[model samples]
Target: MVTLDWTATEIALSLGISPVGCAEISGYKTWVNVANEGLADAVDVGRRQQPSLEAIRKLQPDLILTSRYRHASIARALGEIAPVHLIDDQENEDDMLASVYQSAHQAGAALSRSDDVARLLESFDGEIEKLRTGHAGQVEGRKLVVAQPLPGVPRLRAFAPNAAISGLLRKIGFADGSQMSAQPFGFATVDLEGLASLENDSTLFILGEAIPDDLLHASLWPMLPIVAQGNVRLTGIPSWPFGSTASLKHLARQIVTRFV
Candidate 1:
């Protein structure tokens, strides 16, 4: 099997299936960094948007998995090479966590690994429940703004209520405090002034790389109530906020250990 979607690659790896080929292997390693060992033997097909059809054909895969969002235009072309399975990237707009599970189930069915997927999801549920019960008293009901500082820019990409990370945080009892509304892609890019509407007591959970020095030392940085109260936290770990079940599990452990 070959996977052109990073999320599909993750789901395949979680099910103990190593794809014969994957797109953007290096980007996947840097961004969606979970289950990497599964990719060790896979051939790089090319970029997610424009995968090398010749390279994929060389793999002679029986099945090809890709995102509807990214590969809808090339679905027919991919089908010519092999049976193509389109995984909806936007399966459930209102509940991104549910979307992740749905995507996993879809991949499992295609790969005939439904049993493994079921076990994986069951374990994920138990782990989430344990974290929820254990940290409810300490973190429940706290408002959180999850944001990623754009590299070399002063803007932030804040996850909205419908984002996967926000939904996972909600399961662990924290409320989404981002002022942005539900967006199809899950986040909104905003300038620092846009964050002024957030509640004073809300915690700012900055994802990915550290905030650049320029932004941290901006004149308006310390004026925010959350900054003044020292409620800001850098994850200090690479995170793919839009990843699958394993990625969510990884992120949940990171949040609890680093901030709880």
Candidate 2:
């Protein structure tokens, strides 16, 4: 089998299928765990922007997994090689966790591993319960702002109330501190001043990388309540904020690991 989408590859691997071919970008360190375990012997299909059609044909995979958002246009061409299972993310766009599970179930069904999907979700639930128990006091009635600091850029990518990360944070017991109006993509650009406007008790979840030193020492930085209270949590774990089950699981684990 071959996976043209990174999220699909993650689900496939969680279901115990080692794809014969995978898109190159899916092998990044953000997905290191899955790549090392499931893609150790997979063929790289070149860059996602310009995947090698010839390489795919050489693999002769029985199935090609893709997503409607990224691969709908290529579905026809990819179908010529094998059956293309397009994972539609927009159907459950408003509910990211549901969309993730739906995508996982789709992959599991295709791979005849629905049982594995169920088990994975069960484990995720258990882990979440543990995290909720462990951080019961810190998160109760508390709000948080989950943002991605764009390296070299002065602005931050703040997760809107509709974002997947925001949804997860709310589920784990923190309220959304972004307080921004909802958008289709579930994110808004904000500067330090914008962040400062949020409630002081609101913690911060900075995803992907740490705040650059210049920003850390900025005159405005010390003024933020989170910074003053030492509530700024940095998660250097590379992850797709809008990713699938495995990525979500990885994120949940990172949160638990950091707090514990």
| TM per prediction | 0.96, 0.88
**Best candidate, TM-score:** 1
Query: Which parts of model 2 have CA positions greater than 4 angstroms off?
Result: 25-27, 217-219, 257-260
For model 1, the superposed segments whose C-alpha errors exceed 4 Å read none
Name the lDDT of candidate 1: 0.85
lDDT of each: 0.85, 0.75
- lDDT tens digits by residue: candidate 1, 1-260: 99999998988888888999999999898888978888999999999889999999999999998788889899999999999998876778877778888888888889988898999999998999898999888778889888887877777888889988888888988887766778888888877787667789888888765776756878888887888888888887788888888887888777766655
Model 2: how large is the Cα RMSD against the reference?
2.3
What is the per-residue lDDT of model 2 for residues 1-260, given as tens digits with 9 covering 90 to 100?
A: 98887777777777778889988744543444554566778999986656788999999999998777788888889999999988865456566667776777787777778888889888777877777777878666677777877777666788888777677767777787756877667788888889788777777778766676756867888887778888788777576677765676567567546655
Enumerate residue pairs that collide in model 2: none
Tell me how many residue pairs clash in candidate 1. Answer: 0
